[model samples]
Target: MLADAEKNGPKPAPLIEAFRRTWGRMIIGIGAALLGVGGFFLMTTFIISYGTDELGIDKSVMLNATVIGSVVEIVVLVVAGRIADRIGAWTVCAIGGLVTMAVAFPAFWLVDTGKPALVYLGVGLGICALSIPYAPIGAVVSGMFPEAFRYSAVAMSYNLAGVVAGFVPLLATSLTGAANGASWGAALLLMVIAACTAAGSFASGSLMRRERAARPAGDRVEVAV
Candidate 1:
């Protein structure tokens, strides 16, 4: 099986050529990655801190929520990927982004209520929202580039986004503190980030469609080849 797969695998494209052909789409992918990944990290961080310090939730409860949320995320991720494959990755991601943005404020509001069940519900909803965009992001990024440069372009975009996302925890903490322990400030920031991700996914999808439209039928086949 390994030998057969290796023999049939696609050859890697020259990186320089791939970058030249897909640079614009790569840029859009990076932007989407930054916002989407950053928002996810920020929300997780806020939940941990805010739940413990402000809401006085028990540590065991938070841990249980984390475990359950992880399961929900994995399930949602698979379902989201299947949905994206049937319709379109960008459409799925855009819809996910909108859901995430819409839920940000309410999720925090629920947590602040200091009710255990509501807190768990809020965290679960947030995880589900994050999973929607997270699941289809890889497909969307890969589709932005030709097969030859696909791996390199996708890695670069995702890694760069990871770097940006690394700062989100600190930023969320600082913003929340600045607002005098108000979670709204952090929630608002997350909403903006999620919105940016949605816009980026929408734009990337539009660009991909335009590129396809501009190509001659024969050229499109050749390019894919």
Candidate 2:
């Protein structure tokens, strides 16, 4: 019967074994997380709109916030990498996402004041806090596998997430009703973005935890080389 063939299908060759044993579930979880990362960039468009229309910030303030935020993101990521060994990747990234969302409120609030200068500090911090944990996510994915399959599995998950992250902005804009609410609505929509990140992060951490628990406590298998 077809059911019998499906159950007793030809065994995969060694080359394909790696694929067969691949962590498809884990990869999917991270790819979803990447959607939010891509979404973060999408929010930038709204950010610009908020600064100019709501906050009445001059072009210079917006420019400065962006430049400063980039610089800080680089610095903080370096620091985050060093501490990852102690805390584990999921913990660090989850915390990073939370902190990023926590600070986003005030960062966007400056739009109400219409003074872009007031936002530089918050934006810089927001970027760093939000972005630093992404580096650890790839490592987390790699850790789930034996050495042999680690490379492809890890790369697949991380790259897919990046691709998803690219579309986040457009998604956010549409969700927030960019045309209808304009500046004030854009600010409010940031909360939705934060919610997405929180949900993604929660699912990622929980799934990793489940995987970790599934591994035999005394039978550690190094990632497939």
Best by the TM-score measure = 1
Question: Which ranges of candidate 2 are over 4 A from the true structure?
Answer: 1-24, 27-36, 39-46, 53-56, 176-179, 182-225
The reply for model 1, stretches above 4 Å from the true place, is: 1-23, 211-225
Alpha-carbon TM-score of each model against the true structure:
0.83, 0.68
Output the TM-score of candidate 1.
Answer: 0.83
Clashing residue pairs for model 1: none
Q: Tell me the lDDT of model 2 at 149.
A: 53
The ten-residue window of minimal lDDT in model 1 covers 216-225
Task: List the global CA lDDT of all models.
Answer: 0.77, 0.58
lDDT of 1 at 94: 86
Error of 1 at 58 (Å): 1.8
Model 2 TM-score is: 0.68
- Relative to the unseen true structure, what is the C-alpha lDDT of residue 125 in candidate 1, on a scale of 0 to 100? 81
lDDT of 2 by residue, 152-225 (tens): 66666666677766555555556446555344444444445554555555566666666666778885544311
Q: Residue by residue across 21-110, what tens digits does model 1's lDDT show?
A: 777776788766665578767656657877787668887777676667778889998999888888888888888889989998998888
Give the CA lDDT, 0 to 100, for residue 180 in model 2. 55
